[model samples]
Target chain A: MYLIITALAAAVATAFWYKNRLNDKLHLGALCLMYWGAALMWLVDCVAAIIAGEEEIIDTSLNAALLGICSVALGLAIWLILLLIRSRRNKSQATSINSH
Target chain B: MACFAAPLAEAVITTVLMKRFEKKEKMTDAPNESQAGIPWSRKLKWLNNLLWGGSALLALEHIWHGEIIPQFPFLTALKEPGGVLPMLGEIATVGVGMAAFVTLVWFFMIKIADARAKKAAVSGKTAETEPCI
Candidate 1:
């Protein structure tokens, strides 16, 4: 579920970025990287579990999954902060330009 | 549960990293350039799409496997026989498939953008520049 929600959020952001390609001031590309990195990490983990047999290493796989989820969450937090900072900076720049 | 704690920790780490990056961006006076020719912002965009597509595909697989339920405490459904490991296996399969698809699209987009730029250059016209929204 965590993976699903995070994925959906990333997908929505990507779509938004594409739609506003003409005026992509926010740099959503970073956000996409973070999400995709997390997804890939989890995917690798899933494969490891299958190759080893789930019953043989359930606890280990669970820990790995937890780690993957944490990384995704972290990526999201970073993206949000980046968005805020970029927007603020852009606003200030625009205001200065207008004043000049 | 680790699931709950992960997000909280992630938030803290993200905050620290963003602050560091912000300071660096300020110092350089080159807001877009961070680690070289490739802009950090653009890199993030591609990465974000890849993950989003992967996650979506994984979710769909989970739904097919009955690992995901629409009810309350949805995650608890994974506590069955094979447990979360099997679900992870499914996620891996679907995630890779989707990531590949997203990558292909990204490649095509880049190719198109490059073509447009080349065309503009040949015609002695300024390429359309992207503005911040």
Candidate 2:
């Protein structure tokens, strides 16, 4: 399920964020915010479906689970790309500071 | 079925607000979090990023389900005669709820950040000050 996958990503990001609180360079906090926001949205969706009797809570079919995994993978790939960009920016910033 | 549209709409409105704040920030200073109280635009940016990311994923999932299409009146639900009302109802309830919940969470984040900044200040690390000679 998208809910489980996204929530798991959020947990991992939250842990990393907690550990790296001293340094804001990684921007894991932002990553955590993104995933947690996703998880919350999915939660609301799941609840709404249940209340409406539209869908089951757990759709454990192979295709659905695979899709959820793919979505999470895509999300993480984007986060990694962002981290690389920020790190490069920070590096350039540090060089300018040193030159100054 | 078009529930994700709610947060996506919210994201558009927030993107506008964020751009306005960002322009103000640029006029004042760089987009630096090390600045006092962080920046309103930066704080708002957290919300914008979350909403945008979530909306993108939801939109993709919906598209995969063929609930959305790459044509006019993109939502398939809209194509059904007399489908407008039910789709609107879903958006009103689910979409609004998701947007409001995210906003509430953003408020909590702001509070936590403020508290952390205050603690750092108390520890003499948050601001630049001249030392006694």
Candidate 3:
């Protein structure tokens, strides 16, 4: 389910943030924030679903897994674009400094 | 039942506040090395990002599940007779709880970051990296 995927993303992102916290030119905070937000949201949804008893909480279906993957990919896609921009800016700044 | 709406509503308000605080911070002189710390606006940004990002996915999941519709009234729950009350109840409980929980977590994050900032500022260590907080 989404909760699981988001939680995994949050964990992995946290590891990355911890490693890069000191020299975070990549701005891994974006990844952490997005995944943590998503995980929190999905946690609420899972809890609500448990209360409503409308569906199984642990859905192992292919479609559900695919959807969760897509959602995570979307978050990663955004983070990747941010990283690229940051990288480009850093490169340009370095070039300017060298020229100076 | 549109539980994400509660967080989205809170995010809208917080986003406005975040912008105002950001503007105010911009107007102020930069904090000296001895006073290096996170601004109120930066702290608010943590909460704002969490709420906005979380709400987006929740809304998308709701739409995917057919709980939300593109048509008038939007929420499929509203189509059910006498459904408004239950839907409101869900929002009140689940939605509000979610927003409150996230706010609570953000509060803790700010507290920890503030503590670190205070320690760094007192020690005057550039290596402390308080600005990132």
List-wise, what DockQ does each model earn?
A: 0.16, 0.37, 0.47
What local lDDT does model 2 show for residue B26? 83
lDDT of 3 by residue, B1-133 (tens): 7888899999999989999988877898758633655777888888877887788777777877899999999999899898899899988998998999899889998888877777787877656455352
**TM-score attained by model 1:** 0.40
Query: TM-scores of the models, in the given order?
Result: 0.40, 0.81, 0.83
- Regions more than 4 Å wrong, model 1: A55-74, A88-100, B1-133
CA shift of A98, model 1, Å: 9.1
Error (Å) of candidate 1 at residue B129 is 9.7
lDDT of 2 by residue, A1-82 (tens): 7788888888987888777666656677667777777788888888888898975786777777776777677677777888
TM-score of 3: 0.83
Looking at model 2 chain A, report the run of 10 residues with the lowest lDDT sum.
Answer: A20-29
Error of 1 at B97 (Å): 16
Summarize candidate 3's per-residue lDDT along A16-70 as a digit string, tens digits: 8787777776777767777788788778767878988967876778877876787
Ranked candidates, highest TM-score first? 3, 2, 1
Task: Choose the strongest candidate by lDDT.
Answer: 3
**Rank by lDDT (best first):** 3, 2, 1
Which runs of model 3 end up more than 4 angstroms from their true locations? Answer: A49-55, A80-100, B33-36, B129-133
